[model samples]
Structure formats: structure tokens, C-alpha cells
Target: MSTSFWILCHDLKGGGVIRKSGSIIKSIRQHTDAWINVHKLIPRDEERITEISNTRQRMDYYEKAISLREAEDVASLQEKLGRTLSKAEISRIGVSKLRLFLKELLRKRYMDSVPLIIPLLEKEYNNTTRKLNEINRELSTLDEVKLKEKGRAFHDLF
Candidate 1:
């Protein structure tokens, strides 16, 4: 890979966080040979993969999920409601983002308990990180897609 391509691919954040996933896909399809193969890459042991069985089964479930989503008329209602969902659900949500959000939230909620003079994450850093870690671990293995669907996109995370 070229230097620019390598840098973009290895952002080292564990996953991509660009604002426009669709745009990235379009760019790669138009300009590069770096298509992703989820089946080839995803580790099978990490989670359950329901046996789709056949096209009828796949189509039936997909249509059902789509209809349910239409009934709810919300972007991610299907995922939140435990209906069939797509990979965008997982990619848009991530462990690191959740941890960061929780960190800022705790600081905001307990501002008086935290020092104002010192930089954030400087004073009582260990304590805060410890609590966040506990929270993260406790919340681990949550349906990442569903939790992400619940998060607000009112402001761009990019």
C-alpha cells in the first residue's frame, strides 16, 4: 500500500470512525482494490452466527425486519427491537466510543467531585479510569448494535 493508503487503513483506533462510511465505500470501489470480505475476516468464535439455511429464510427474515422497521418508522428501530439488522449497526458503534462517552459523562455529572483547576483526566485519573473500566466490563457484550442505535447522532462524532 502507498503511505497515504496505509495511514488511512491503520488509524490504530481499533476501528474506523470517519463521518461518512458510505462515502468511504464509494471511494474505495471507485478508486481502489481494498474491498472488505466480512465472512473471511470475522472470527467465528466471537459470537453466534444463525444458520440462514436458504434464500427463502434469508428473504423472509429480511422482509420481516424491514416491515417492522417501517412500522416503527425510525432509522434503527429494527435493531433496537431485536429484529434483523445489518453490519452498519456494528461498524457505527464501538467499544472505544462507548468508553470515551462514559468518561466525559462521569466528569460532567460529578463536576464538583472532580478538580476544576487541573486538566481533565489528570487528577483522580486512576479512580475515574477504574470506575469506567468496571462500567465497561459490566456493560461488555451488550448488543453493540442495539446500544449504538440508541445513541444520538444529533452531533457528528467525527
Candidate 2:
């Protein structure tokens, strides 16, 4: 018999189904069960995966901005000092300390560039830091328990 016939029989009340067609009925029951289990859950899972991807991308951009700012600071310092300053030295001195030192140096010796460079660098650094903190808060709020329960792997989504 066609699946539609079985479906019609299933819809009718008191439709006496035969034992010979038990396998077909069971197959239909399994299909319905799978459809019900997966239908509503997948969209929610995909949404979360998208959220995770977007959050990570934002974090990466901020982190890269921070790194680029550090490199630019080091380059500027090296240019003014007329000596090589390794990135490792800047890291060892620490970012805030280095920025403070650079600001002071620029103010004392190269006073003209102070207005143009210091304010913009400070603003960019502060904005990036604040955005990174906001991204962290967003990450903390995101829950992956539902995806885990659904047997969805993060690796597969990436």
C-alpha cells in the first residue's frame, strides 16, 4: 500500500491496521519521531552558531587592532630614539607604561606631532579595549548547552 493510504488510515479513528503492515507503520512512526525531534531545534542551534562565529570575529579584530597599535608605537619610538627597539622589549616594558613613556617623550622633544598622534592613539586604544570587554560580556552570556545536547560539535560548525 502507498504511504498516503497508511497516512489516511492513521488519521481515521478506529481504523484497524493489520499485523502484516506492522513494519510500514513502524517506519512511519520513526520518521515522524525524527521530524518532531529535529525540526524546531535546528534553527535555534544554527542561530547560536552564528552568534559564536560573529563574536569570535569581533574579538579577533579587536585583538589585532591592539597588536597593530603596539607595533606602531614601537616603530614610532624606534624612529624618535634612532635605535632599534624590539617588540619583545616593548612587551617587557608593558603597554600602558610604554604609552606613557612615549607620550612624555613626544611632548618634550617632538612637541608638534603630539596633538596629531597622541590623542588619536589614546582614543583608538581606549575604544578597542572597551569593545573587547563588551565582547567578553557577550561571550559569557552565550550558552552552548543546547547545541551540545543536540550532538552538534563546535569543530563541525567552524
TM-scores for every candidate against the unseen true structure: 0.17, 0.26
Best-fitting candidate, scored by lDDT = 2
Candidate 1 CA-lDDT value: 0.48
Model 2, position 136, has a per-residue lDDT of 98
lDDT of 2: 0.52
Error of 1 at 15 (Å): 24
Per residue, candidate 1 scores C-alpha lDDT tens digits across 40-128 of 12332222212212123444465587666554543465656777556665433444235445756776878866566466557579789
Query: Model 2, 1-158: lDDT tens per residue?
Result: 11111122221231243234455445545665311111122221221111112123454565588788877877888899999977667764436355446656766877777788889999999999999999999988877886575566656676
Worst window of 10 by summed lDDT in candidate 2:
43-52
Against the true structure, what is every candidate's RMSD? 26.5, 31.9
Instruction: Report model 1's TM-score to 2 decimal places.
Output: 0.17
